[model samples]
Target: MSANEVFLVAMLIIFSLPWLVWRLCRTDYFAPLVVVQIVMGILLGPGVLGRWFPDYHAWVFAPPVVQALNGLALWAVMLFVMIAGTELDLGQAWRHRRESGITAGLALGVPLLLGCAAAGVLLHLPGWVGEAAQGWQFVLGIGMACAVTALPILILLMEKLQLLRQPLGQRILRYASLDDIAVWGLLALILMDWNRVGRQALFLAGFALAAWGFRRLMVRLPEADRWHVALIWLALCGFTADWAGLHYMVGAFLAGAVLEAAWFDQARLDQLRHHVLLVLMPVFFLSTGLRTGWSVGGGEVFAAAALLLGATVAGKLLGVHLAGRVLGWPACEAPIIGWLLQTKALIMIIFANILLDRQIITSASFTALLLMAVASTMLTTPMVAPRLANRRAP
Candidate 1:
């Protein structure tokens, strides 16, 4: 077959199989279609499908086909991250500064501390840390991974629960928004290259100037024109960030972060996000799955996943409960908030992908983190639905 033919076939399999399974199994109550696609990616990866059906795997995911899919995945994730950045309502967060700050801080901090402790334990065991990792890089990377809340996924869950536009849902977004800032800031710190420090500094300075001028230009343009201009700006920022030895994803986030969300129509923006998720992100999920490894043993990877899941879930609940006490929130609020914030499917996976790309974490560690993310995401709706059903809204 021609490469294009094979690539099309592969793409067909990528999109069809997940939807088929998701439809047949009816897993939406627990595992959303997105989560199922991620799981399907893992099953189709080298660790599972390749091991069992090596010849078929090799034929379907041939080098050229994989490369084609990777290009799609790269652009998909870049746009997804940019949209995530654009959605950051820091103005809303700032309006509720005290409540937002306290919740966001504790929600992020407690997991970080516990996750660091878990990292310390993992360090003692070989094959869990990456070859290029420094003691601090591995420790901090894993810690932040645990602390991450998948903002995109959180928004989806809230929409599913019919609380998306409610005051409660808006409040959750505020907390997640603040933590999103912290997550990216820490990632920048972790990814800092001493040898390329000058370039990094130049990138930041250049970005600031470009962002200011771009914002001015965006404000002047009509909304329709703004969309095209934003894509152009996304490419520029991504290219510059990659040139500076920071990741393109970071640059994509910055590109959107500097702009006002008010510049775009909210309904249209939401539709764009849904379209991206439906059409592009499954390829990203497949590419992510292709990277999963079991070199350290499946049992060990799963064991580590369980440990990290416990740390993440427990830490989030404990932290949010404490925040509730400090902020004088209603009694019914914290549990729902904690369970909702524990959604870590997409953003955590993105964070881990960057870590793996930087060689700060090995494939084994990435696999473990991937499992934890999947489990935590699966737990969110089932756990929160029951709690929210029982409790009265504040």
Candidate 2:
């Protein structure tokens, strides 16, 4: 076949595989959607087909197209945030916020500190990527990766356990939402620091705080569909962060915090998610898989990926167990909550991709981290859900 035809066909399959897998699995394999999408991309891209058909990844998931696909990812991320907001029952979150926050606190804090310490070590190793990875940037990348959670997977689990509307679920959801926002803001600052793309630590913090104040003042103007307001604000937020040399996701996330503060509705949130979930988000995933570059092969990369997998297992479970009691959760449920909350695949992959593309980290490092995230999600999901099946709310 002609090279252009090869490229066109590869693009078509990579983009369509997620929905196709969903259909093929009869939607049974829906929970681990990100993993499915990524694996399929690997099969189709440089991992397998791309090795033979090099024209595909270059033509399809290239800069211009990936940039366009990012808009959809941004939209999904925003809608996901809004849904998180609607799911937040203030009474429940406030009642449990102290403990809920405590849980979030431990989960994030440990990763931040440990990842920072681990950075020096992870940096010395060869990266899956070709770039010259540094000390603090290595630290920042791992720390941010440590702090993230995958909301799509979390939502699916909530639905499966019938925990979407329950008091426990509401509390967990609110805190998770808050945790996500905090992590993104911190990550933006970290990325800026690593790349020297913009201001350093103090400046980014001040900018974010000032921006928060400005946002609080502006969002006070209520709109008919707060979700739509959120969509516009999300785009603007991401654009702002991008302008500031931070990843656009940073801006989208902050805009979401403002949206949550507005008191949105479940129905509207659902509508927003439906709008972005199918084609846009799937395209984003495909693009991410293209970047994942399963072609990376080496012993050091494999070892580091294994370590990350172990950390995801031990660190997340321990973090959850530590904070479960304060939230009024029983022993039986605490472990489940810990596992499910730590499942990090899609969002981590997206965040990791930004760092890789910017040359802040090596592709191999990204690959290991991707492997870690996928392993964590798989390990956590089955352990958490089935155990809590009996305790599931109606």
Task: RMSD for all candidates, in order, please.
Answer: 1.0, 4.2
Across 1-394, the per-residue lDDT of candidate 1 in tens digits comes to 8888888888998999999999999999999999999999999999999999999899989999999899999999999999999999999999999999999999999999899899999988999888778989999999999999999999999999988899999999999999999999999999999999999999999999988899899999999999999899999999999899889999988987987889999999999999999999999999999999999999999999999998899999999999999989988899999999989999999999999999999999999999999999999999999888877535
Minimum summed lDDT over a 10-residue window in model 2 is located at: 81-90
Find the candidate with the highest TM-score and give its number: 1
Global lDDT of model 1: 0.93
Question: Model 2, 281-340: lDDT tens per residue?
Answer: 666666555565444475666677677666655666677777775556687777776676
RMSD of 1: 1.0
Q: Which residue pairs in candidate 1 collide? A: none
Q: How close is candidate 1 to the true structure, as a TM-score?
A: 0.99
- Residue 366 displacement in candidate 2 (angstroms): 1.3
